[model samples]
Target: MPRRLVKVFARLNPRRSPEDSLALRASVLASILTAELTILAMGYYGLITTVAVPLLTAAGFYISWRRRRERNLLIKLILAVMVVAAAVIFLRELAGSLYDTRLPLIRLFLWLQVMHSFDLPARRDLKFSLVSGLILITAGAVLSISMTYIAGLALFSAAAVAALIQFQLSEDSQRVDRVVAADPWRLAAGSFLVWLMLVSVAVPVMLVMPQSTQARLTSLPVSELTKIFSDFPSEVVNPYYREGGDPFDRPPQFSADSYYGFNPYMDLRSRGRLSDDIVLKVRSDRYDFYRGIVFDVYNGKGWEMSDEEGEDIVSSSPPFELPVDTSMPRGGTSIQSFYIQADLPNIIFSGWRPVSLFFPADRIKIDKYGSLRSPYQLTDDTVYSVVTEQPLTAGSYLRRFPRAGDPAAGPEYTALPDAYGADILEIEKLTRGLTGSYDNTYDKVLAVERYLKETYPYDLEIGPQRSERDAVAYFLFEEQAGYCEHFASAMAVMLRSVGIPARVVTGYTGGSLNPFTGLWEVRQSDAHAWVEVYFGSAGWVGFDPTPGFDMPGDASRDRDNFMLSGIIDYLGGIDFGPAGRAVSAAGAWLGRGAAWLTSVPLAQLSAVATGAAALAASAGLALRRLMLRRRQSRLATAGLSRELLRDPSLKGYLRLLKRLAGIGLARRPEETLRRFARRVSLSTGSADFEELNAIIEELRYSGRPRSDGDQRRVAALSLEIDERLREGRAATGRA
Candidate 1:
């Protein structure tokens, strides 16, 4: 048999290896493609950056294949220099990412991966490329909050399994100068089966792991302030929605692309189903509202900010103090940074009582209401930071003050249009009814907020409010069910009529915190409005009357399955009509169940136990089959020593070696018997394996057949090694 195998090997010379198989090359490309795709999903790439990266990667692979005829040191040196330059650029850009530096580092490696693609001349280099795909995918998984990552991960895993399988075959084929026992389709099916098994194990394991509720964040950021262009009248420009006439007009209104409340004059009629597209990502020290455009004037129809002469804040740079109210008491300091993910209004959003700015624009217009507006409209990738001294807003502090009969918030806030008519009286009567029992302004605000939340359910499906009636009146008396806009508008107008200085504030409610990124993902659906009531010396305090919504200051402990919700949103957005909605609804149910399973300790523990047992059983069956096949092959074949497979001592030693390999002590093809014995000795923490190797070596070299006593001695050593190996593996927690 040995002579026949030698003759076969001689027919195909191992010295001059053949070109890489198409399967091997394609597998390598698939792995590279996965890494590139992961980098693109991170949302930082520009149009050119997005298009150029994958093109460069594909081009690099093509170059490597064509240039495989010869190796070039110069080419490698140049690519190395390019990678180094990319790293230098990344480091410079990293100045802005210090608050969360993981992403920029990952992005740097992505660029390195692209540059290194041109030099995968050897199988080892291709394998390295395959492994780097894992690194990139893992990094993307860590930073990405979207459920779309799950799909990308699936793609990478399948490709990686196939790549590893092809690599194994290629390595073996290279050793013999020809493919051995090759069945491409069978191997392909095996890879798929392996992937399926892996996915099955991973899903249950993940389902069993407890989810963390760590949304509250305190982080920092990147950017330098640019000199302002002479404080341009920062107009509200909704890039996706502004395909029309004045936002303030009646005829051309209600855009699905934009939140109506973001305009100069919010028309309550324009409230529709806002898209679930993520708009902003915020990293802040504490949970708080991203306060934006504040409106004091209620025109019966909607609300608008008063045309007070605003001050243009022209500064050389950022971190400058804002003109804040000296009368308002300062509490804990909170720092926040914003990453604009979508084109938005020119308003600068910050936590309550913004003390300083890190805005990029040279100048910002500060309205009397303390809201800041930038000269430039915010576009995607716009970055800024803010330092805020949160108002002494604890309930205990606010409860100490009484409701001022005449608030010091000035007449603009309390001024209601006479056009509101008797409808205004009805609002006053309702507000007084809700807050009549409360002695202090804080309690009064809470009472009105609670009443609205309980009585008027927040429903986004409601149509535009009637143009004939006051928006607030219609919301309170007729519909009694509306979203944040109607609730906020009603609350603001109601408070004003009842002699409390209140204004409607619009911006995004800080969305769910991404546990991985530590950033609040603010979606378009998260766009919200709430009322801020004045309490003489207490300053402006925020209140939300929308159902299922709380004040911005409150930290959210109940983090829903946001990842699953993202999946639902993604599915819902696909233009599949009613079927898409059904899919979305199904996803919602799954998300809820997942959230429950993760939250409940008993459920998680049970799942872990079940999954672990199933995996263990499967592994045991596979290992048993593998060992049985190897044992049968060895028994049938003549090999190893002078006595061949018939010799008892040699057979015993071979069996012992196979046992060691079964428990993950497999010897490499290049390892000598003595070297392999040494490694097994370390792995199993037993010298018995070495003793068995020595006996077999001595007997084989001495040209003598093994005696019965020698066979018994070998068996004894094997038993001792098995016992010790188990002890060693268990000690290391790998058993």
Candidate 2:
């Protein structure tokens, strides 16, 4: 009779039947649960969904794609398109933000997984999904330092376990599947063991891997030309001065008897100063300072060309020729070396004077005013080496003013501005104050230098100045403190007044060397200026009077604080101090405290203890099975079990009623006993829906969740829904 009722019910309803296979059931559960868990985990960590969702989706796609050959061609095509679209989006995003532009690639992985969910025709599809899960977890790790990666990994592990379970059961359905379900304790124990093994092995590999291993690392913007000057430019500043005066040489270039002396120029850049932190390393044993530009004269408002200027500097493609006037002494000196790493522009800095320089494959050109330059900017690190000539000191040439026809006078110095006469007198007073006795020009110059160094302090800040203040006079007498320009300019003006020619010079001072690469890391802040007093034979003598400051090659370089910065960054990794530490400790202590509290029977730990609780649960399930078997077994002996099992209608209705209760509106002891019957009798739905109501009333009101009569009703509903809803939707949509 129950079997007859089941057949009637099955005819009326469908989809009440169990899943076609164990793998399909497990896959559905794993995918849905993993998706939900990953979403929650990423959300809790405060990660943007663009990163999290795409990662999860990619995992799904990987699982789907792994079954390539067996998957339907149409489904594969759809998934492929999704993957490509995701990649495009990811690359486009990279152009916007420097952060997490890699997410779109993972998005493709997700769309493929969704497509894979449709047919799932073979075991390979299940395997593919598992692989995708693993890939997704890996992608998540790259995007953050958050613990959400750990959670995704855990979900992946769980899915793997479920996949394994399904695989094992599917092969021997009658044996393994039923046998495993036969004892819930054994199945749960097996799952625990598997989880433990997977996590233990995975931890070591994760920890030992190199963190910076990225597949595509070489993406830099193309090199572009960076111009230093766009006007009628000279490499060196202040290039013109009067005859009989050489500012680069120390001491007086002329005597009072001659009336010829250094003509002082008002430094134009004196106010617009340049600063930099550019670094260069000299790897050669013989120290050769890099030479840049040389200013040969001084003009009142800074120097410029007195006559025809030279050609524009050009960057060449390959071979280069030196532009030095060879008829003059071959002052060239060879220094060989290489650039370890440098990222400054092509403008290389060197020592005081140079005759020739070897250029790397790129063409290097010298402008009319003697500045060597290149067209391209160095965005990435570049390296090169060269040779240069060193200037001799003052112990050689006798003190004497230049003749009227001499070439060093460069015709530009014949005229002095009429307005400078008053300023020159003020300088004479300051220089006279520094000296009481007259000797050779060098000694007299040294006396003035000694006085200035001892009397004035150095400062870089520019504060309010008096309106009529002369820069040189104010610094030497009133302010007594200023940056490099002030000290250099003051000395130049004082020397010029006393008939001892001098000029101010500017360039970069050598920088601190990086020990790791032994390369000098020069920065913009090293810009410096000093007075180059004419010393006749020794060319120009470089001496600094910036109180307590030492020149390069004169002092020990101080080391940087890289180690401290590294330690600070490392300490920031996991929460440790005050608020973060307190939060962590409180969370940890809460777990222990809760565990301790729960040890008293009802809060956390099982009331009966692990062993006792397991036994109790086992007994409950066993008692239920026993009661079920006893009631059904007796009826089976009467030939009812086999007959009812074959009755699809009864089985369908019973399954429908059970599934309905799960959705909500579960049967309760307080529910009226006749309520279910009324629902079935007056049901306006299909016959199978009505039949399920009556059967549920019989079994559930009778205090059983299922029965032979109910089973038939469940079978009918299963057939009905399968045909009407599931199949119908697809057919109409496709049509």
Candidate 3:
């Protein structure tokens, strides 16, 4: 057998070798192609500026030039540098990508590859470069799972095959004196075919593998996604500006004034358009607008609302009555629940005096101010059910309040830095004038709210106008047309001036309701702010001073922008485009209306559809087989015999092997005829094994056509093998 194999190889090419020039050419081409793929993957055109690409090109040219061939070192070097430079710029642009920003790492790998590209003195360097390229492509896969990544996978596989061919070509080059053979295209095409076959088999195995068994990793670099509202319960210097608009069109942008942790980064001052609909959903029996950090003192630019240790206030729970008057009537309602998920934070946006809040799972914590909080960064959709009560009357609570005696309420709320513009006293005066007397706090709040709604008109173009000297005052007195913040701020300050206690509340309001699911969907456009009036009988009455604006739970706003809802619909094969509409129409025509399907319980419908599909497939396959059999019967048997008997007699032998496998031993494609026989021999009982050998020998050596009688004997042998396996199993069980 070994001698026969040697003869076959010798007949083909005992002394033939590929030339050095051809081998060198293959390496150079591979390097260049590899660089091109890297550039395409990174999506940056300025890679030519980097030294890496040039270095690689030079290395390739030098090797070629040293043998007296014309090669340009400078051109090679320039290409390498440009490719690397382009890659860097591409990565730099993805500073905010959470997972798909590994392009920089790929650039570094590509540069190393370019630097070593031309120096392919040893086959090892060339092989290593190709391998590194494959690694770079694989890394890119971690960024995205799409058709583009599949293309990269194909490219990587093809490269691997090419590398193998290069190794073979290089070996042939070293022995060129004997005989010459070179065909780069043929080698590359062969490698690609082999790679494709390997991948076809690998795909099934990969799908079977559990995702958890593989690495759970993110490709985002040093900078991670940062939360905007982390300093929960912190004082805000909120001189409210206009708020409320479409979140999808433009949303509010929040950034820390200073760096918090180790990650060093800055923001470009930009603001998103306000969302008119409330993004949050409160299911509490009691009504309250969800609240976040509150700023007591305004510094012209922003508000300072900190609930730090020194700023913490005493709680006002029942048993241990607050130092303030308990005689003040409290609102009867209790246990208000809220389901809120927004682009904003988990800092609760609720009525001022919240008694308790029911959180999703155990995610809620509280700051010293009794403000609800989140366990970690709030990214996913959240459902918060809070329990709260409002004061019944605003008048009684304002009198002889604990903080009322103290001139400075708290450092965070009172402190005015040097940078702060002087508008505090003016705001106070206007607030006092709006609310006539401290005894009628609710009346004062209403007066202030009415003034804002009557005075300023709602507009998004106020930011630039309000950026001038005395912007808030200008916005309240002069501009006449501003957004929610401008109106809400004016209202809050006016209420405070009359000693009718009040605070500016910023949160989402009036949400859009999804007709499909009957759930309020909040979008980026739902971000909003309104005034919370102090009522002694009720803790804090939630109110919106924006003239035409409805209070929370009024249920007038549209809410269809859940972050993942859109993405989930996409993954689940729900399309809203023209193609999707066509598909929907077709489905309806086929008695599979989209509405009906959506109405069905997801699990039950999926099960029923799967079963129906399986039945249909089985029926179709049976029909196809019956039709094929009928066609076969109409054909002449003699012609079938002629075609089978013409050459090789390989078909009969293959059928025999399959029959043998059906019982016990099976043959692998990679195995030789002899190896298959050896495995058959090991099976206990010689009934079918002996008979099989007789047939193989007759077919191989004798080259004789088996008679009908002989064919029957082979069939009998196949059945005997089946019996042997059955008997073996029986014996094992009986023992």
Candidate 4:
């Protein structure tokens, strides 16, 4: 009854369906399967689609094969219904944000591909399936943010190529009204080999290569707000850090996934290393520090935000206009979208001097230190966008803004909190000695920054500071080696002692720029701290006092070594070991060679290349022609090599064709044997080979077994054709 209803809804629209092609169906099926796996790899579903997709596609394939010969009006009608349903689902899913439509659109297309699989009776429908699979791969690439998607892309590409080759063979067979000799295995191998050759040619052309991957996404705008329940509107929340736990005692350090500096208070007394697990992915216009939280009140041990009661602002729409600090000199705007890959603090980490936000949360808080905060902890996959005013960060440009002590920056920024000993006095004396030569605040800040970096070696293996001894004092005077926090603390302390308004700021470094994905991959190990020294109208300019770290700035072109980025980092860490320096030296030499090549004019190189290619092509053509002529001459004179025939039945036929070719009467690729024989008879003024052609035709199509009489007739006919060809050749020569 259901089938009758469906049939009644649709007509028997039998649209030139081809004979059941098992090979073509299998290739298309493989391609569709590859695409499905790719979408799964791209994190399309949690459990529902993951389990349902495979079962549904498999069932569809089985059902399609079972009813391959049927002109099922019911199935077509159902598919039409599915198409409409999918369209409706997509339309319903459409939202204000572009990113919001991605998953729904993918789901729609993917399900449609699955549904279309069940009714693929025609070669055209199978081709449609193949093209649909290609689209799925493209969709996967669009969604992919890692180089791992290459595996799926490669698999789908091979399957699609095989399907195309099969499609071509099917078309050929249909045109000739017979099954082609090309089998599935041979088709796949030949097509893949051709595909590889095309890829090889294309790779160099692309080079003349551009990650071969770039930012497939224009924006990552999202809106999924989480309500804040804490006393402070936007309090720092680190899952790894124990909030009410004993301050003196260190928290459990098993995974070390979160950075301690991300908390409200950065306890220098706590010593451990952060994991390299990716915490964030940022797509930005340029590279800059993703500053999270800043601390003004600093004790001898650690740093903290004194003003916990921050001002909160609410906005229903995007983008939330952040209050700009009038004192901070702003320049061009930068748009950055942060994609949280791991649990992080509530801090709205943006480029320096943020003026606007696109965070999901309506209510956001801004503290005295100019750090914007979200309502809830940024869990995994949480995304937000921010637009910041990137200053003209040239040291000379900043130095132009002359200023004494910063009036805008309050006294809390410059004060050294009380400690046990006369450590403050000793630190003040030490800082004054280093900066006495420089008059301006910027120059003094530079001097302090330079001094700290030169004296201290950045090390992460150092033990926690003693309870009594100050962290920065010990780092500067005693230990002489510490990581980012140590360097930042020492610099900030020195700046404050020299009557400069400075504070320690913590967040992630401008992360590893994945050339493949074209996104900044910020990891837990990227958690960093640096000193922000206030320069009146120039504002709080960041300075990296760590030995190997550079202060994040708006670089015109920030380059990362892509070869050493994703894979090596994903594994524990990279270690070239003993010969690391030698490898580095070799890489340097290669870089120099590349640099030299870049200096040469492209047009001159192209001209020389074009000339060489033309010359090579001429030589190749000549060589191939010479080889072919020699082979043909040898074959024509070989006198009865019929024993070399794989099928003895076709030996006489082949012989006839070869002899006819010697007399300038070669059989065309598209010509039938009967038509060629008729033309041959006319040319020779004889009808001798007609009988042999008939025997072969019967054997080729009707599968008629050859008898002794047939074999004798074939031999006599071949000899007669050869004689006729010789006579024809002689007559032509005489003429």
Candidate with the greatest TM-score versus the true structure: 4
- Per-model tally of clashing residue pairs: 4, 76, 91, 1
Indicate the worst ten consecutive residues by lDDT in candidate 1.
10-19
* Cα TM-score per model: 0.70, 0.36, 0.36, 0.77
- lDDT of candidate 3 vs native? 0.47
lDDT of 4 by residue, 1-735 (tens): 987765665555744565477877888898999888888865646678877776788788778878878877768777888899888877876654454467778888888888988887777788788888889888887677677887887778777877787777777565422224555577667888867855665444433322322233355565465454444555777777677764435542323787888777887766777777888888787777888888888877788788766788778656778888676666778878788887777778998888878888777888877788777777877778887887666877777654555456788988887753477778888989988987677788888888887887788898756546777788777787888888899889988887788899998887767755667888789889988877777777788888877875534234322232232332223345767655766656655554544455767755765676577668768976887566554443233233435566656657766665555555544567787667656666667767767776666567567788877887788877677666655231211
Instruction: Choose 2 or 4, whichever is better by lDDT.
Output: 4
Model 3 scores worst on lDDT over the 10 consecutive residues at 258-267
The true-versus-predicted C-alpha distance at residue 409 of model 1, in Å, is: 2.4
Rate residue 728 of model 1 by lDDT: 59
* Model 4 lDDT on a 0 to 1 scale: 0.72
Candidate lDDT values, in order: 0.72, 0.45, 0.47, 0.72
Worst 10 residues of 2 by lDDT: 213-222
**TM-score: the better of candidates 1 and 3:** 1
**For model 3, how does the per-residue alpha-carbon lDDT over 124-200 read when each residue is reduced to its tens digit?**
54556666666666565543322355655666566666666666656644541111235557766767776775676
Tens digits of per-residue lDDT, candidate 1, 1-735, equal 977765665454223232466677788788778767876866656677777777888888778777765545557658767987997899897775555576678778877888888876677778788888898888776556456777888888999999888887777565422224477789989899889977877765554444333344433443545666554765555555554454546543665656877777777767558887889988766667888888888887777767734677776645557897675678878888888888887788888878878777667777777887877788787888888887777889888764445345679888888976889998888888889988877888888888888887888788766557887888888887888888998888888888888899998887766643556778888888988888677778888889988875555444433343434333444467776666666777877775665466765666666878787878869986987667444432323644545665455556655555455455554567687677656655557678887886777678776788888987788666666655654321122
Model 4 C-alpha RMSD vs. true structure (Å) is 7.5
